[model samples]
Target: MFLGTGGMTPGHQLAERDDRKTAWAWYRGRAVRDLANGYTMKRVYR
Candidate 1:
């Protein structure tokens, strides 16, 4: 799996093989992550 760097024009690419790939981006006052199912992971535990 591959990850992306966040910026004004961040880019990403990924290939999965039974892996939980995720990507995060800042929006409003929340930290959200992307999943393979096209769902935003809005839960932060850190």
Candidate 2:
């Protein structure tokens, strides 16, 4: 869905995607991976 990026700055608030929690979770995981390493993703269980 071409999600945008986020940071301590403004103009990027992802929390608005409350209707698509799965998309938000995946996006969050990717963002976390971008900031760190060794991120292993399993099928979403929640």
Candidate 3:
């Protein structure tokens, strides 16, 4: 089962014209795993 680990919030500030993103973790040469809601996941195979 996945755990609910509280973390930073993923947000974009319109007033400050900020477009930012964050991820929990990443893996290479493999499928990306799903994280808790609002969490981003990425994988790169080199």
Candidate 4:
């Protein structure tokens, strides 16, 4: 979650364009892999 948020945070914009692309790609890939492995979150409303 933090990786996804960090990828889009304002501070990310300060990075070089190439670095931003690489970071975003890495973050996205990690998310996809996790989902493929069945990692999930369930929300509980109380």
Q: Please report the candidate that would top TM-score against the real structure.
A: 4
Q: In model 2, which runs have C-alpha deviations exceeding 4 angstroms?
A: 1-19, 37-46
Q: Write the per-residue lDDT of candidate 1 for residues 1-46, one digit (tens) a residue.
A: 2344454222332233212233222342153223522343344422
Worst 10-residue lDDT window for candidate 2 reads 37-46
Better candidate number, 2 or 3, judged by TM-score = 2
Deviation of model 1 at 17, angstroms: 12
Candidate-wise lDDT, in order: 0.32, 0.57, 0.29, 0.68
Off by over 4 Å in 1: 1-22, 26-46
Q: How close is candidate 3 to the true structure, as a TM-score?
A: 0.12
Residue 34 of model 2 has an lDDT of 69
For candidate 3, give the lDDT of residue 14: 36
Per-residue lDDT of model 2, residues 1-46, tens digit only: 3354645224334444454787879999998886665333233332
How high is the lDDT of residue 41 in model 1? 34
Candidate 1 local lDDT, residue 35: 54
Q: Which numbered prediction scores highest in lDDT against the true structure?
A: 4
Ranking by TM-score: 4, 2, 3, 1
Structure candidate 4, residue pairs in collision: none
What is the TM-score of candidate 2? Answer: 0.38
